[model samples]
Target: MKSSIKRYLIGRPLKSNELGEQKLNKTKALAILSSDALSSVAYGPEQILLVLVTIGAAAFWYSIPIAVGVLVLLLALILSYRQIIYAYPQGGGAYVVSKENLGVNYGLVAGGSLLVDYILTVAVSVSAGTDAITSAFPSLHSHNILIAVLFVLFITTLNLRGVTESASILAYPVYLFVIALFIMIGAGMYKIFTGQVTEALHSPIGTPVAGISLFLLLRAFASGSSALTGVEAISNAIPNFKDPAPKNAAKTLAAMGTLLAILFSGIVLLAYYYGISPNEQETVVSQIAESVFGRNAVYYFIQFTTALILVLAANTGYSAFPLLAVNLAKDKFIPRMFTIRGDRLGYSNGIITLGFASILLIIMFKGHTESLIPLYAVGVFIPFTLSQTGMILKWLREKPAGWRVKLAINATGAAISFIVSLMFFLTKFTQVWPVLVFLPLTILLFHRIKRHYEAVGDQLRIASCEAATPIEGNVMIVPVAGITHVVENSINYAKSLNADQIIAVYVAFDREEEKKFAEKWAKWQPDVRLVTLHSQYRSIIQPLTKFVDIVEHKSKEMNYRVTVVIPQFIPKEGWHNILHNQSSFLIRAFLLYRRDVIVTTVPYHLKK
Candidate 1:
């Protein structure tokens, strides 16, 4: 039943020739890779504050330090991953790097981590976008889950059409968000500098609590690290870039890095300057919009634009998940389903699977952006650690001319990323570990799947025991049912076997019908004789088994081996099996118990 449903959802397995229909270009690839990175500006600041607020109002200032740290980490990661893209242009990304440098276990860890991160990217981006929309329309506040699910469905449909299409559609909205954010930041800065600043607009109504602790700082850092989530996508997607893949990928990485740092830093600064509370209660972007543009046309317009960009940002997952699955498929870590392209030439199955998982997450968390935050940094940090580790290994192996400099850079990057990853894990374990539990389980599942495929491959290998060879004095028995295509095909198959003697057997369930069939057969081919076996119980298997036993006994006496050619009808529909029952299967099963008998099926394709 599940197999039937899968067939209905994805259709039959496709041949290799069908894969070429969908191909992605550099611009589209860049758009996809950069969307999630750029879109973080809308919520990364908010997430930081959401965490810091737990430590009291003064902890809100920690956003500045955390943002700076995140910026440094982001730049370091970008530089390190640039080396990765140059070294490996394949689409394996972190998994490929870790597998090559670290080990298979490390690679599995990286792959599993990246898989979870990509899933969270979709969920967080959509939920954040939903929050933006709900802020615009308070009525939607309670129905965020429904909105998120519908948005996931909508994104899934667009992705099903193909990556190039979804990327192209998303490019404009993401670019618009970038432009709008820059304008808002510029205007806010102007207001601050001109001494024309109005009362701190959108300021929290009550005085915020004031205190700080090491745990709060760690939480804030983890929250800020959300901006770093999509940075590795460019490295993983080097192959999707245009010709001169390495250079194009490097440039895309640089652009993503610069854009994310500027946008995220700008939002954090503006929010801080305006006395916007890093309280979990308010989104930084919402406060900024209300402050800068007032609760009027411009404020609402910015809200609408931000919401659109945030939602469209999920296009990153729509693009990355399919490509990641394809890489896994190539490595045999995932089923061949991931390698298949849909009618539109996209990885439709992968995209739909990603969408479903995202929707489930959004629903499970009730589209609450804050609750999903704990699970957010864990997955991203895993890939960051491994990717940086991969770079360090690459530097070690190649030992470039500036060996000392490159090694130092890679070593430092790896150490920092590793530390931050550990911090994120420790800080988020209580709130995030539940979602992260899927990581190791996924790795084990992939390993098992790989083992299963290997076992099947071993079974399919040709064995010397079954090698085709000439049979000595082979006797053939053809199961006949009157003068029909089934009988004709079975006889032809027996002749092809090069048997010493061929006997046609007709089983008599109804004596009169059997007699009529024998008479007709005799009239058509007088040279060939018909042997009839009577079944008083009207059971085909019992009569066939008795007849085959007699034939084998006779063949043994003649010093020959017997082969049976059974004529079988191909069922046009699944229901056709119920109409005809399992007579052929029973006969084949019975014949298999005999040592010297070889049972072969001669299929007769029946017209619908």
Candidate 2:
């Protein structure tokens, strides 16, 4: 029963042909791929300021340089991954890339990293969205965790329903948010350039603080680099795209990159221009909205957009987690259950598991985007580094007839990404070391599962030692608590057993009731003999044990076998157990202690 439950939770195993039914068109597919990248704008700026806070308000200006650097990194990474999509467009993602070029351990590391990042993406986005809403309505601030958990539950249920359903629901809000953000940024930029900017409602400048260090700048870079988290989603989801997978995926990647760059730059620059302080502020989006649209409009707009983006960002994981699981299952890294398709042809078990994990994170972090930000970027960067490195290795091994310049570009891209990843890890480990823990744990889990499968195969390969033979006799035992359906079934089973002697013993705590029952049974069945046993404490086990001993003694004297019959009822009915007694198990156990006596159960099915 326990094994059955585990199998149900893990889902059934499936094959490649089963996945053909899940094919998605380019537009819907692009939405799934771009969700994480596009949603980063929701919290990316806030993360930048969170790091800069230590350096005081003046450090806010550093956001511009960091944003610019992120833009450059984003373009480089996107172009590199575009090559990835073209080369292996079947959605092998970092796992496939690293395995093909960098070896299996590297592939496992990359896969684990991406899996962790996908979970964090959902957690952080949902938490950030909840925080934004609670910020708008401070009354809900204290209950943010509960609210976030509820939101996670809702999103999880939606995703479990199917990927296409989730994608369709998410598309409108995400697109609306993108359009709104662009309009706001464009308007704010116009206001800044035209010298029409009003002073930020709450200027982050003029705040005094201590000295700044290179470490502070590096930390800021690490935080700002979070903007690059979702770029790999495109590569992971390439297989879900319409025909011409590589071209569509590349177009989606490029589109996502350009929009993210423009949005991140605009929000950061506008915040700086309006003198919005990053150190003592809400999200950069909030500050920009407040600066451009005044307190009333921007406050609510930021709230709404943040909520929209966070919810939509979860769509990335909704699509990616199952696909990754399918890949892992195919490679035998994970259990075959992960490879299964659901009724909707989606990786239902994987989606549900990812959703549940994300919800736990949201609950633990209380939907605070700031709290989740540290753990967010590290896993993403690990995969980014490995993936780019894989691309370089692929380029070296395949030596495809790509232009020499392109090969050099891929190598340079890989080198730079690797350096950035190392830097980010060093700077952010204090904050993200938890995710580092997850990486090794996941790898260990994979290997352990692999070993388990191999062990099972080994066990099943062992040959049977003995041949089968027919039994000479079969003895059945039935225990009855009262003269009801239970006893009736027991009598039927005893007759069916065809044993040498069938003993029907009534364990009587009350002498008067025992006498009445014996008289009644004698009148009903003259052939069946009733043995009445006395119990001072109304205990079933002691009386049944004594009765079984008597039967064994008689069997030895008469040279005949003893069979005890126990009547069992279906446990599914609610009141069956309450109305009936559990004498069957006790009687069975008592009879087992005796060498010659055998016990059997007679089942009585009750309507639920």
Candidate 3:
């Protein structure tokens, strides 16, 4: 029944051979992988204006220069990541580049930073989408949190349905957003060219709260840099492309970068010409739409598509984060569960985890895009800086053809990215300090997880057992909860092992219960010996495990092996499981770590 429900929700289980067929073509890949970068136009300019607006109208002039700076950085990243795609086509992105060229610590830092940034991408993107919705219908303002969470859940469900399907579902909305913005930009341009509207270069309005300083400009630049957050995703997800993955991925990266540059420049340019400023009540894009189309159908179309692409922007995170987790898991830096594909051939664990984390961020910040923006850029730039630096070292060490040219591009990217990372840390220190603290702690966590997996591998190494010969005798101990068919089957199974001795161990909390069980055993006349243990504290697992340890020691001294067969009943209904005691489960859990102990469960399925 559960399987049927799951199949209905995520579609039928995909076969392993169907994986190749699931790879995305360029159009679908661009829509799925570039949505985050493309949708940043909705809020990126506003983030800059939000900072500059504090100094009144005169400060708005800085938005253009800062946006240009961000564009320059964006170009450098596109060129650099194209190199990354061709060089590391296997696509671990920054983690792989940094590890191979810059060493493991740098690699882990890049991986940890990218992981945090991906979560922030979903949260900030969805929150911005919610802002777009509220801008269109102010009555929905109070429900932004609910709206944002629902968007996350919806996108997560689509992604869990697998990549190609989600891409097909999401591609049209992204194109709609692009078309709507271009129309709005063209309409605004037409007005300007036709002398219908003049440049908004009015004098300062009201008092300037803060003077324009280098710090203010840096703050604005850092804020605008959020637009570049998802550029690396194309490189990170190169393997998701169809055959000729790297070449196809590079072309897609160029296409996405081109679209992003045009849209971002158009929006920022039009906002400047229209004298748009950031406001709490409406987004800069919304204001631009209204300026061009005045709350008409076109304006609402802009808002609707903006909300969609913004929400679906999180699809980029869903695509890349799980793939990153698979890489990290393969290195044993995280749980191996992330490396396992779901029935739909997607990394279901990573997708669901990204969903929940994004929702938590939405709730914590109350679905305000502005509040989440400060935490977004720093996480992204750290990885950007590291990845570019890694590429530089790779070019230097390998010195392939055109190495100097490639080196120059990546060096420019590294320098610009590093500067941006530092500026964000310094300017947004108060809001971004937690991220500063999180990066090192996350690296430390990676180290700890790596150490644990290494230790487990060493302990379970099969090569270490080559010299150890098998013993002649064995002792089978069965922990019985009651005189039921479960115990009967467990004992019968244990007897099949041909052990020299069999003990049916029972733990009784009361003297009367022990006596009653002993008489019942005597009446059954089982050939196996019954060992009744009295637990004064009513602790069944501890007593049973301790007895097993003693038996294991005795068997070791006699050159025999010890196996504990636990009898566990299988309830026909999952909900009925709560009605039964789980002593067999407890005993197995307690004995699992004992080096010489072999614990097995014999299940007796109940029909009703």
Best by lDDT: 3
How does each model score on lDDT? 0.77, 0.74, 0.89
- Which pairs of residues collide in candidate 1? 57-209
Give the lDDT of residue 305 in candidate 3: 98
Q: Candidate 1, residues 306-337: lDDT per residue as tens digits?
A: 88877777887777778888888888899999
Angstrom error of the Cα, residue 173, model 1: value is 0.6
Model 3 worst lDDT window (10 residues): 200-209
| After superposition, candidate 2 runs with Cα above 4 Å error | 1-22, 198-214, 279-281, 297-299, 403-409, 461-568, 571-603
- Tens digits of lDDT, candidate 3, 562-585: 899988889999999899877777
Task: List, residue by residue over 368-456, the lDDT tens digit for candidate 2.
Answer: 67767767777777777787777776777667787465566666666656766676668766766776677788999988988888777
For every model in order, what is the number of clashing pairs? 1, 10, 0
Better of 2 and 3 by lDDT: 3
| lDDT of model number 1 | 0.77
lDDT of 3 at 167: 97
Candidate 2 CA-lDDT value: 0.74
Best by TM-score: 3
For all the candidates, what are their Cα RMSDs to the real structure?
Answer: 6.3, 6.7, 2.4
Q: Give the TM-score of candidate 1.
A: 0.76
Q: TM-score of model 3 relative to the true fold?
A: 0.95
